[model samples]
Target: MNNPYNLVRKYDIMLKDFQTISTSFLVKQLPTATLFVDMKLRVVYASDKLISLFCDEKVNFVGQSLFTIFPELDSKWETVLKECLTGKSSPMGVQSFTDAEGKEKFYEWSNASWYDSDENIIGAIIQINDISLAIESDVALDKANILLKQQSELSKIGIWEYDLQKKTVYWCAMTKTIHEVALDYVPDIDKAIDFYKKGHSRNAISMAVFEATDKGRPWSLKLQIVTAKGNEKWVLAAGKPIFEKGKIARIMGTFQDINEEVVAEIKTKDNAKLLKTLIDHLPLNVFIKDRDSKKILVNKSECDYLGVANANELIGKTDFDVYPFETAKLSRDEDLQILETLKPILGKESISVKKDGSETVFLSSKIPLLDEDGHATGIVGISLDISDLKQKEQELRNLINVTSLQNKKLINFAHIVSHNLRSHSANFSMLLDFLVHEKDEEEKVKIVNMLTQASDNLLETLENLNEVVTLSTNTQAKKEKVNLHTKISEIQQNLSEIIQNNKLKIINKVSQNIDIRIVPAYLDSILMNFITNGVKYKHPDREPQLEFSTEVIKDYTVLSISDNGIGIDLEKYGSKLFGMYKTFHTNKDSRGIGLYITKNQVEAMHGKIEVESELGEGTKFKVFFK
Candidate 1:
């Protein structure tokens, strides 16, 4: 395929130049590092110093996920980063982190939306400058302390120090303000320790201070403290011990109010828990699994359906443990396929089995769970049980079939009335003409006898037609379970003399207990039509062979009757196979009404018939009944 946008041609030239210029420019910039990201959250270029500063390895960064290198970034960072690439500039931010060696580090980062020569938005350029040493320099600390002394009224920050040698405490004005105390109040080290809250917060502060003073360790902790007003406040208490000649002299620290942020964070976590609780109580089956197919979470409905007491019993387990081997394999493969394609599978029909051994049909959907870097990490699947819906669907189909069968019978009835009556009336007129033309008494008597026989034949045809009309009108018949083999046995016996005279062989393969939902009379009539047709159409060259078999399908039972007899030319007469007064054979016994009435009776009981035949060989009729 040819490239539509001609991007391939452009890339063919630009990529070679990019590797040279971009790599060289990044290397020359050295410790002032920068990273270029494509729209896909992948690093298109990274400076050597950027990798060394954060990862400390000669690891390749190009073509790797930006989040893979910086996993601490969350959805908020992703949104801002993508916004930058979409032509919005992000705010300048400074992040404080710790290095692998446990040294404090800070980085200042800013984003710029970059574009290609054609004015197309390519990606975002993020420049990162290491500023830890600059921020921590003694000159800067001194300058900051001086500015703090000059200001004296910033309410969010406070400074404090402890003198180990003198066993004294000093609190700045902001510190006293934070404690809600008088500026002239005097305090010692022990009195200052009483300000922390009574239990965990006080103990944590004490431990942190001890480590700072005894081991020259700097500590940053978030804890609650009690003010002089007797109200609790959250504070960030950070301290660094000052050592002189390998002996501890003093410890200095800062405090900032963090109570509001802490409260908001707690509420966010509680909201997440509440959302999970809501999902667990929903009426569908829902579950989440990891990339390895281990269960991460399951809703209440899923747990109940799987026969597990609760999600606790399922966590960390695979489907192989909770389901049959084949079902588990099928389910796991679907989950893996969704993850691999990063696409959702919606409304897929599936089957499940209940604890009581009944089967249920349902619809399921699975979605890929992705990380901030847009990598699929797991899958979430939901299944809604549609067994009741399926049952209703089958009922509707059965009703439609019954209605259609009734309509077919109505049309055939109209044809029988018009065509059969005309034929018999014509025969009556021809017999009268013969009686009028006769000149001898013997011939006239013979004509009268022929007319009597013709009238009797017409009456017989009318009786058969009446039987068909009654079959179509009767709807109150009960559908009892009829054993198919027993029915065929009774039919064969009724035709025993005919079968024996023809030297016929009967093979009954139907199960003895196989039952079908059919009216008793309809069953007898349907079997009789096919059985007699098989015998009547037997080949002159061979003895007749009949075979009967049954099969159970999803919604019905099927009965098949096979015979080695003269077969029907379905191509020639298929459209009128069950029409009124239509016959396909030259035999005198083919009244043409047998198959038409047979089809009506079959359908009157909510059954159907299909025929397959080769002209010279054999015929097989398959009947379906509920």
Candidate 2:
């Protein structure tokens, strides 16, 4: 549209002026090192900064090839210059080189072909930047990342990032391992969420990620994951939101495997439940106390007995706090004894004071509670109330004492009466002797037989009475520690004749270590009586087979004698089996006094006897002695 020559010339002049100004301003004010290169790759025009960096001298380097100025980059410089001058784009990463003085420096270079208004490539314009510190920082960061990766592998920790805007997920190698996925596996947001379990784990992770992305909230949670191989695991996850321009950009976090720890916690909870159930249902009144004597646990029965509202009220309170002074003092003393001994203290007498201020006696036992190192850390105790039984026993003892005193007086009177009767009988005998000489022989014979029968009856009654009195008296005062095996052997020797006559087979399983406190004479008599009875009651079809053994009961030794012979009907004669003159069998020697005397001797020595029998199977008698 500009056809006039004068106007065209003016426009051309104006365009030239503008180009010169633009180039001069760009060379002086550009951030990077700007340079112009010729066809030979020589520096044609360079900014003052570029000149200062490459050449210290002020002389122009217009005709010098770049390789000549920097010979260290000879071939690389020629190739890059040629590509740019041929109208190609060239980009390079930071590289280092030595200058003329051999000082090392780093730089980043970008080159593009410069064109004239005719659109023809003329020369190259190159942009250079000093990046030594930036390159060094990048190298350091790479090394730190390598170290972090090694640590994550060793600790089984995993890192991950989720870009909210792109809906993409990126995982580290350790993160893949935590998810039990292959190294080459590509995970997206949805696929990553699916790795979590289908229920709570998936729902929780989704919610946390959503909140982090939408509300910029950070989250930490423990969740469960189901692996590709159908294995379940526990993982601790923590994440923080990344923000750009006041909006969520990404979410990054770590994951740690905690399956072992979580499983252990679950097992501990289950075991605690089982222990609580056992404590609640136990029959005895049980309680647990801390090392400071403060009650930590009290069972239902214990709380009811104390008239407490609940077990919680009893916690942090000691026996002294809730009980009377006298009762608490005795209990404290017993607990101290247990601590001193580091052993269980059993059968301690204690009296509990109730809320109503009533006293109840109990037999209490305490055992030391041990800690992980097997040291006594606390105490566990059980109490059995025996107040009512104790009262009844006291009443029975008073009645028995009175009856014994009256019986003693009656025995003295009987002795006097017997003496009188003997004297009268002697006188009658003398008179009869005189009459016999002068009277009929048949009448004298009758009187002599009658007197003989009366004397025999009186002597037998006196012997029975003396045996009863002796059995009723206490014999434990003479008790001493004796080896049960030795005593049993001696008894066997004494009864050897009877054993042989009856062809009895005796099985003795008694150990020599079994020692018991009992009267020696009583032990001998008891064993002898049991052996005689076994032989006497032998069935006609089988020879007597006796088994003798001893075992330690709670606080005593029990001597068990069992026989494989005709057994008694316990259902019919159970109560009166040991009664005086109670005979079960009809025999010439069935006096039944043997069992009666055995029972009396055992009770006198503070022992008890129990029997178990069937009609024809066999019989076993257990004699418990302290």
Best candidate (score: lDDT): 1
Model 2, 1-626: lDDT tens per residue? 76699898999999999996787677856666787777677776678777777676567676777777666663666677788888777774556777787888899888888787898887888888999888789989999998888888777789899987788899988889888889999899888889899899999999998888778899999999998778999989889998889878899999888888899998998997888778777767899998778899898889888888789999999988888777787778777877778889888777778646898888889999987888788899998888887998887896697578447635753774577468657766775776567477777777777667767755764676577667665543588888888887888888999999999888889998878888888888899988988898888899899999988788768899999878999989998798656798876777767887788788777678999998777899999896
Q: Report lDDT per candidate.
A: 0.84, 0.82
Measured against the true structure, the TM-scores of the candidates, in listed sequence, are 0.55, 0.42
Clashing pairs in 2: none
lDDT of 1 at 15: 91
